[model samples]
Target chain A: MSLNVVSLVSVGRHPQSGRARRADQDGRAVELGLKLVAKALSVVHVGDPDDPVLRQYAGMGLPSMTILKQDKSIDAVPILSQFLQQEKIDIVLTGVRAESGESSGMVPYLLAHALGWPVVARVADIVSVKDGEAQVLLALPRGQRRAVSVKLPFIASVDHAAEIARQSAFALGLRASIESVESVGEVDRIRVDWQESVAKSRPKRLKTVKAKTAAERFKAATAKPEGGTGKVMKNETPKEKARAIFDLLLEEKVIR
Target chain B: MSNVSSLGISSLGIVRRDPRKEWIARNRLHPLYHEVINEGLGSVVGPSGLIRKNPHQIGFIGPNGIKRIDRLKGNGADTSNKRHGSAQEVVLPLHVVTTPDFYLVVVPDLVGGRLSSHDKDILGLAHALQGGMEGNGAVVAVCFGDVKETQFDLAGVDRLIHLTGTEFEGFTPEARVAALVQIDTQLAPQHWLFPDSIHGGTDLGSRLAASLGERPATQAWQVIPEKVVCRGAGGSLDIARQTPRIVMVLEECGNAIDETRHEVLPISVDALEIQSAHLIDHGQVAVDPNEIPLAEAEFIVSAGNGIHNWAQYHQTAQALGATEGASRVAVDDGFMPRFRQVGASGTWVTARVYLAVGISGAIQHMQGIGQCEKIIAINTDAGCDMVKRSHLSVIDDSDVILSELMQLAQEYGVNDKPSQENSPEESQNVA
Candidate 1:
């Protein structure tokens, strides 16, 4: 049986400029979803339908993208959950984590919980889908892949290590339409109350010191000394180099 | 000092001195500290007061001389102001009871018995609690698995709720999540913290969050009083929950705790029933203990993008009796196995000497070897980050240096005649 795969795409934000764009991982997810179900794939987003970044997905030749019109006050999980519930969706594909806005990396997990479906994270590739089970290659640390089989009607978050997303076509971008749907669920009061500000690089932490007396502890804790410049070696022969490396190793006790 | 009642049970255990030696071995028997030299790093001082001298650095000066104790030996340092002329009868606190508002659940690495470098859930939890709550309300830790009371670095925790059983053994996801759920229901903590690491943490946190009807923030970096801040696309985003119940999976917190305060709390063991699930197959994937012995390897020779011949690098590692490690790119290119990959996502090796070959140091790769005592880089790029990070960097071809190093090893009898001839294909790593 052909699967009904829903590509859950989100507008990614640029790191330095905070400009809305197609998240690299999410684009890869869209690419993967297209590869898996092809004509049956439906693109879904839970943000502004008129947002310019939504066109990036459409430019990838998606015929139509569904935008569940959720205001910033509404939680994406409940909105996406309600939207997905109305369809016979077999799989939900999203990026491992969103690049901007709440970036909890929990949307897929939350969706799994809300829909009572198993969720797999860091998915590198979908090996095969057969007999109500999907065999997948999970991306582990260090570029390793683990083969795991999960029963379908599941959610998968594509790993950054997956294939690069294809470039958006200009002609397709002109033709594709954003079908806006009514927002679902009540506004999440807590999310709406959250104060938003341009994020700055975090401040340096206070140095913790262990000392005998309170006075000495305070002195040591606040002492911010300049670190010494490291030594750079040059023009040494192979044997001499070997000896130097060996001595340093021995001093550091790398080898007995 | 008049404040005797404020100390915890672990504090009392310290007062019971070893009569044989006046100076206490500062470092406890946590598996991590077993191999490290305990002279400067251990608790060699007389039972004097421990102070948070510096971040991740603790110092106690006595007749034995000033010594820096391992920060991770015990729970957070005791704040009790006690001075001793010698090993006089030390006052020990019996029990510490407090109503815990925050719960830090430390799921044991059933495979390793004790938590490894990768699992810093407890540390992050403590930091978050101290940062947000200012250590006010109780920071209760619920440890699940065959973990002993002493195994955990319980520096900031107020109460330890240990759940251990034969059924709770191994990386049993269902049993572990069930146990945490039970604790959540019983304790009803305002904030719940889990390690946002790959090792079953994501699964547990997600399941627990779902079960409790609270959205969990995975890989959260900061925990303020009102919200948990995590890195999103543009910058950092704060995850604020309307209700009191917040499930958080922690990523790396910037600072490491000092060992000045070793407050060992009383342990309350609850044996939970085995909770079974058919979703994920149990006993399927088992990480071999010896597969990637990168942590314990004294010497490591790591290959990077520059090394085209991995077989030669592997042979060089065998010649020097060093563990073979690779950068992410090398592993990605299929030159080396993922187990041999070294970096943040890979093994955090505390090897005494790390020999880098042809690898430009990426920040992620540099994090893995940050703990290495000495780093020697051999890269053609003179200005690569690895060169700056290394103690000795040779701006030369790695192939020449490796052969020379192997020759030197053979001359020093480090590589036996038979061993020198053995190829990488004949012998495989124990991992």
Candidate 2:
């Protein structure tokens, strides 16, 4: 039997503006799902389908998406986990994080915990799937990639290094329809008394230096006024030049 | 790529430069410095001539209007040093180390099998937290496996708890989580701190948070007695945990305090038994030990995208006996491995001296080398960001300068090879 694959989608924010927009990563996850399962891929979302921001994602290749319409008070993890369990999904894919809101990047982990499946984060690309196992290339920092294989019934979060998602076609976006399903699950009761306020930039930290008197304090305060004093050697002896550099290394504690 | 030769002949290949003056001259502000001024936070210069950071004053307004004591300029009126009256002293019972209130769990780098600088920073933070509680709190350093307590500087720790067992070894997430969870159950520390130094820290922290049913703050930078200052979404977030049990993953806090002040005390060892999870067979990737000597090496030669010949850079590093590092660009271009990349997302370097080659200093890269005592920049562009951060800037072809430096080292018999005294086996935990 073919693998029952599901790709989770969400409205991502613009990188700079933090405005609600189509999430590029979710689209990439959809792309990966489509490559694996072709047209049989199921796209699921737990938020409102009417949230116009999701249209940008709907236009990117996928013809339809399922919205498990949930209340703001309801937690999405248990609902999604139960839904995936009911569908008996063999593989699940999602973006590493949502670009806005509670962008804790905890959904994948929480979902994996709920479903009792291992999660592979920062996946660059899916290599292949055969006999209840999937080969994937994991994205590491500094543009490096590593190959890792995971057993079936696992969750994978797409990284930015994944393929650039296909552009949203205006016509297709207009034609795409979102399927809404009623959410049935217990709401998270852990009260997070959020003191929502405009965040201010962190204050600069001044390194504390012991100054007995005001003179030393003033001098220390006005430090680094002079930029780096550089030397250009034209007719200096190699020994003299090497000695100078060696002194610098010693002074800097690079060489003991 | 041949842009180095494009400079006019009137200018000599090398020239003197002042980074701060150059920044002002070019009207390009250093991102960090600019943020300081933009935030209306007064800038403070340290004795080392580097700008120092000012921590946020936690939830209190002083009686005086000044938010910072450093900003106050004055000579205090001195009451004579001699005591006027008989010393009126209030007698109090001496403080004693007992059950730990604060726990500093140094998670080993599962892949590298070593301790990271951030782990030391977490220890320092735990020390500070313990002190803030007026010597009422005790600190315990927890390590998995047969890690030698001497590997770390346990200055502030009242007791060291070593989980001595072979099962603690290996890169299995299950084993680590089980060990930490079991420790938490046993100790029940009021506060738990984990250093977010390696890739595995986040996973361990989150899993612990989940199992404990508490949301842990990641990238925490500062700690007060009760609250932890964390890097919040878009800014700084101060989180106060109502429950006594709190877990936090700390960022690069630097080796601020001296580690050698306190004498080593006897540590209390606790043997923990954890249930092993089913293992999966898979391939693993390892970083070249010689490439990025972040914590161990004193001298580092780093390459940037402007490097025309990557092999020459490596040769020069070998000649000088210095560890090789790369900017994000060099690593991205596959000229260097991911582990060799030095920047915010990569490894934070605490080397004594850093030599940047053909690299434009990006803020991300600068963040990593914040603790380097001296930075020497060689770039074609004199006004490049990297040059501005360096104590010395060579405005010439880096390839030529590097070759000349290498020749000079050979002639002088510098022989500054990588230190054999510091090896992976020792795994220096004290940064």
- Chain A TM per candidate, in order of listing: 0.79, 0.79
**Complex DockQ, candidate 1:** 0.24
lDDT by residue (A104-152, candidate 1, tens digit) is 6778877887888877878888878999988877765534356677788
Leading candidate by TM-score: 1
lDDT of 1 by residue, B291-371 (tens): 335776667788898986556777677767676788998878777768778999998888768899999999999899888
lDDT of 2 by residue, B1-431 (tens): 00111111234422233344333323434454444223333347999999776655211122233332323111223222112211334232333555444544444342233445556666666667667664356556666654533544433445555655556554455666776777777766667776653355666666666667666655555567665545443332343333224445555553433433332244553555666443342434432325334654567888998888665676667666677778988878777777778989988988778888888889999899988878887777877787777876666776677677777667656554444332332122111
Q: Judged by lDDT against the true structure, how good is candidate 2?
A: 0.63
> Lowest-scoring 10 consecutive residues by lDDT in candidate 1 chain B?
B1-10
lDDT digits (tens) for residues A1-256 of candidate 2: 8888899987776657767777778888988888888877889989776888767767766678889998766778888888888878888899876664444456777777778787777788888888878887776543435667778888888987788677887777767888899978676664254333434454555567666567558868888756554553334544444445556765765442
Counting clashing residue pairs in each candidate, in order, gives: 26, 10
